[model samples]
Target: MKQNITDLSVLELSNLIKSKSISCTEVTDSFLRHIDDLNPQINAFCDIFHESAVRDAKLADAAIAQGHYSSPLHGIPIGLKDLTPTSGSTTTFGSKLFKTNMPEHDAILVERLRKKGAIIVGKTNTPEFGHKGVTDNLIFGKTRNPWNLTKVAGGSSGGSAAAVAARMVPIAEGSDGAGSIRIPAALCGVVGFKPSFGRIPDVAGPFSSTTPFFHNGPISRNVHDSFIFYRAMAGEDHRDPFSIPTNSSQPTKPLPPLNRLKIAYSRKLDYFQVSADVENCLDATIARLSNLGYQVEEVDLGLGLDVEECFMTLWRFKLSSTYGGLKKNELHLLEPTVQQLISEGNKITPAKYGRAIKVRERVWDIISRLFSNYDFLVCPTTSVPAFDIDKESPRRINGIEINSLIGWFLTYPFNLTGNPAISLPVGFCTSGLPVGMQVIGQRLDDTRLLQFSETIELENQWRS
Candidate 1:
């Protein structure tokens, strides 16, 4: 019975809890038990709040008995990325420097989730300051993929992705500066959604930038569960100056039916070397969409200028500015890669940074115009499948060398453009590792993108 609860989606669990078919205490206990048994192998959680979660579960049961009902997430166990602050909980961002740091107030998203009756079970692990795509830090160690423990689980949201894939939790919060959520979701065989910039409130912190390039969104096993969590965490917040005012009337508008759609599929965007397995999987996905009455065409996204150079400059600048005030001793505790990036950022002159910003805006303008002709853009989430956990980055993809971190981060451009993107499991590689297809929509069209993803999943029957 406990095993059965672990398989249920957030919507499914919510229905059972509402109908009294399962008590909140039962659901919480089931998750807690699973985490206790499995977390040792996966390293998905940095800290567990078992006692507080049990107490919250009991309170939920009492409310249900008294005829009080909360939001759809009531009593569902969820994990928080250690980057988000949780009042009274040790919210280490996968760093030894702040291992004992605890916040007196919850982050805006955490406060919203608590109000909606979701019980946070623990803080999931992340790379130090979420600086890299792989989830390993000097403090909490590495988070292994549930499917194949030896392979890497994409990060900085690796722990959240692993937890969802392993059924330790139904949903989790993940922040994406550049494919952090989507990369792990692809590797872990789960659903990852990055809502348009400013759609979800982002609380400011040492790593947070005033620019709306970074976003916090939900990662779940299914589309509806992601939607439910997204709706709950979204809306205007005075604390985040970039948060947009969501019009209630807009959500009520019926989604435009996705029939006879035009999809632009790019296997290798501007000569990007892709793995044969990923190419084959993407071809199959395009066929499926065509069978569902859509037009799929091979399009070339001629993005002028060095996109990697521009994005990295901006990214490193943000990191440097965000953490520039740390003491030298505290800085020494950071990962070597992080320290290297800070040094590079420190060397970037203001004039060079300004030029990079302008280049980003020009690229966005071009991509936006391209979307006007196509309903959505499609590409492989990553150029290659999950690699060995011990390797820092893949040395080669399809026999081509990848020299730097940004070389493998093909999905970062969309993040820079603030487009709504989702990574859906398409197929697996010969190594038995998962491959994912990225469905990208224009900014502020998150709901439509989600609806289209549901169509794709249903047509392909892609369930883990």
Candidate 2:
């Protein structure tokens, strides 16, 4: 069977474009056509740039013809999350209030990708202010999971994950404030990597500058593609004081072999309730790792229930700080969750907020100690698979009611600790939904994490 151009991975398409076996225009057209055919059904894209994409593709081909190859992303079609501001393009942030808002300059990551010859086809949908786990907004509606349209695509990066899963785009950018990248990647059955905080410069104004839990990352069908995106987006920028002060050049130091690494895993993180199907899939993954000569062990991560409360407190605080002033004037325009968050956040005293910060440090201490003993930590990415798109999240997992937006996800802790984490599709649930296993590495050790994920990818051949 002849492979579809849209089905090719980022590296495969890059190879073809570099070899002149395919033109950038041909690749861009194929993806734009696929998006046209699928976006309406899934609501994955909020903005489509047909003319701009074509022009950029032609420019990429021209550069290649002149024997100037920029990087692996040269001539590749990619999608940016709607929250990412792009110059001269509508960046709604998935809210009606900003429906017509357009930035005068591209985000730091967008600038880097464009310089490397990546063609932005459109802006993918996200939740209003990216405030929740599922992707739906008053402006763009909900994004459906490509696996099963009846189920949610997960968010706030739901659109990026769906586009990659449906083969509309081989790679897309995602931001994770609280599992926005990994949550949807797990639900959509693609690879989403949240590098250690500051690895990718997130110069998104005051809100992004002070947040320790937020990170910008990549979503794709495979680990190598995610790595390619990571390499391009990582580097120091004087504007982002938190940005890592490291060169983004390809690393020459080799990572340790996977077989020699020590891995610690928790089925439910010692507190959250996990569904039977997700637990079954994770168990199978542990068995596979054991068979592959990995030293895998189950451990009790003594993260008290206070961790969840502290995370929510900080999340609400961030939201209120950014949008509190609008509550008195534009509250009607904001989504119900965002309004509620802003309301609750305004009531928190400085003392309460400071106490939450203290808990955050304690949580980090627990995670840092675990990393000192183990090379990696693994767990179920989410407690359940993709659920009904109509609701924000499953009302319950294993019959325990989920009261919070990001509670069902097992990804937020890593975000809080500033560790690198990647979600790999492990298998599927009986309901025909995909299951994901999250692999977490120590902070700032992104290269080792990527190499480990690639090794596991080759072993499972999950895409097969």
Candidate 3:
């Protein structure tokens, strides 16, 4: 039972702890042991709060004994992405610039996690300032994939996904600006969920992005744990004007049988090139859904604007505006890739920025109306499967050139539309890397999408 505790899902662990069948200390120790053994190879953690986690676990046990349960996540060990602020803990955004920085208070979401009695075990790694989709940063080095140590773990939430996949933690917090959460989850073979915009608050800090598309969410081994963590961190916070009021009492219903549902499936978003493996995996997944009784049809979402140009224009401008005030030394501290983006952003005039926003709004208007006819949409999370850790970006997909960062990120459009999207590990490639299917639901239909994901997960019996 002790040996198996570390493998249990967050829901299972909560049940065990609540039933007194297991102590929080025992659960924490089991995870600690797993991290100790696996983390050296994966480099998933920047720091491990072994003592603090054990102490908190003991306190959770005492509270349970006294008939006081904090929340669903009580006593569960979790890891925070280093970008999320943690009071007194080293919260480097995988950058040398913040090596000595510590926050005086936890972010609003972190405070909520604490209120729910979750024991934060450590901080996961990210790219410097989460600038790119890979997790290597100057501060704590790179976070490698657990499936194959030599391969790259998709980032900037790479460390979080790797930790969850390697069973270092049952669940971990991850922030996604442009497929940061889903990308890593796809590569590391776990579940990554990015809820609707404003579903989770982005706390006030230097690392926080002003763009509505940026979000903080969760990465976990399974859908149920993802749901649990999402619930724990969601709700309105005065700290973030964008935070939405949540109805916790709203029940999540299982998805209607696939035969009763209409889904729009597309490999390429009209013009983007999809790798052969990605194309095959998506094709097989669509067929599987059809077999399970879903009406799967190929449809092109004529996203009128050049998605890459529009997204990069906006993304770069936001980064430049946010970090432009830094001194020369601070600017030089940024990675070359990030520095290049900032420079590009600086060149965009205010008129161009406004036009980009207009383009985004128009695109969202088109996609939302399309969702009216379909229950959900499906696509490949990335244009290609996991690539070499050293390569900044794959030059081509299925022998077609990928023009820019957003071209490789096929999943960011939904984020721009403020819709809830999830990445489910559907199959593995010939190289043994995992393939993920993006399950996107209509705006504010997060619960339905998650329930559908669980059904698909069960039907396919996909285990990582």
Candidate 4:
């Protein structure tokens, strides 16, 4: 039985290509046709390399004919988040200042993908410097949600998530400094995986390379496909100051039976208001997990309200440092909000940053205890569903007045602690907006978490 080319998984496509069941050009053409048909409304891509993609596809076919297949990603058409630089492509990082900026070489992750025989389709849209929780940027406009055009796709990796969700591409590259990848994956009903901070290298990260919280990972419609893509992109890269040196030399392994596994679930780390839709979806998931015989208990890590301040402090400091390098004359080209955020960042003194680090250390210490007794922690990816495109986050969650839009997110804490977290499509809200359930693992336990995610994915049958 032949499956629809557009419906095939990345691994499935690779297998077909290897077996001569389908040619690389045919697969590339199928995706390009979808890109032409869908990208106009979705705005998922900042640039399109249709001609190059076809050229590469033909080459991929020739390589396979001669038995030179590079990896599972060979001939796979993939999108790079605009924040990622490719040798010949303009990577705008969703800002005006770098709209014309072209790098001398592909970012380390891009090089990794190319070495695996993956075809660089084009650049996906992203917010300026991937600063905010949403996807709108001053340079490339906005990326609309494929599920609901009027709503947001969740961002900084919004375009990558949207592209995967729309079937324009089976997989794409995305980074999560603070939930950039997972947030959108939840909204688009795709799988977003943030491997441990250094599991994937950011040797050419647009912002400061020293920040451990910033991470690179993959986004796909399913966990298994993402596993294949991530393995190709992850490894030790000495150029990246934070890249991990651990020998994770093998592919992800399968999970054992779930009967003895324990997953601790938390609704809110403390007591932030949650929308009814998110709560209901979580409640049902909890019930389902309980029925599956996994020990699911409700617990809190006590991350504290001050943790938000700590995260924001570190984030702003990083952004402020990145913008400080801009030539004074070129400063005017930046987005106003970015300017404001950087201004706030500049105001943070070293003393204040040190204080924030103390709070972060406290969080790491307190949360580390949870792992002693539980294998994983499950939580809502976002406090609310995808809100209005032009706005920040929902003004209120569960009728409680929310102050900052980032306040509704639960992803940053993990980034601060350098833990591995993944967002899977658990279900949807009454409004048809997708709700994601986050599964976090201990540091360096990415393979286990991925196997766990695949278990849930098989049980839930989640797909766009």
Please tell me which predicted candidate would have the highest lDDT against the true structure.
Answer: 2
* Error in Å for residue 264 of model 2: 0.4
**Model 1 local distance difference test score:** 0.86
Better lDDT candidate (1, 3): 1
Tens-digit lDDT track for model 4 on 91-181? 8888888889988888888888988889888899999989877888877788999989999998989999999999999999899988999
Residues 1-464 of candidate 1: C-alpha lDDT, one tens digit per residue:
55489999999999999999999999999999999999999999988999999999999999999998889999999999998889989878888888898888999999999989899999999998888889999888999999999988999899999999999999999998888999999999999999998888885552354342777899999888999999999998877777886565556334454565778988876756688888898898898777767878889888743777788888888778877667899899988888888888888898998888888887798789878898899999888888889876876776777644756656788877889999998888888888988999988888888988988888777774
Task: List the candidates' TM-scores in order.
Answer: 0.96, 0.97, 0.96, 0.96
The better candidate by TM-score, 1 or 2, is 2
lDDT, each prediction: 0.86, 0.90, 0.85, 0.86
Q: List residue ranges in candidate 4 displaced over 4 A.
A: 205-207, 210-212, 246-256, 325-329
lDDT of 2 by residue, 241-294 (tens): 788855546663466576778999899888888999999999998999899889
Winning model by TM-score: 2
lDDT score, candidate 2 = 0.90
Which pairs clash in model 1? none
Clashes of each: 0, 0, 3, 0
Give the C-alpha lDDT of model 3. 0.85
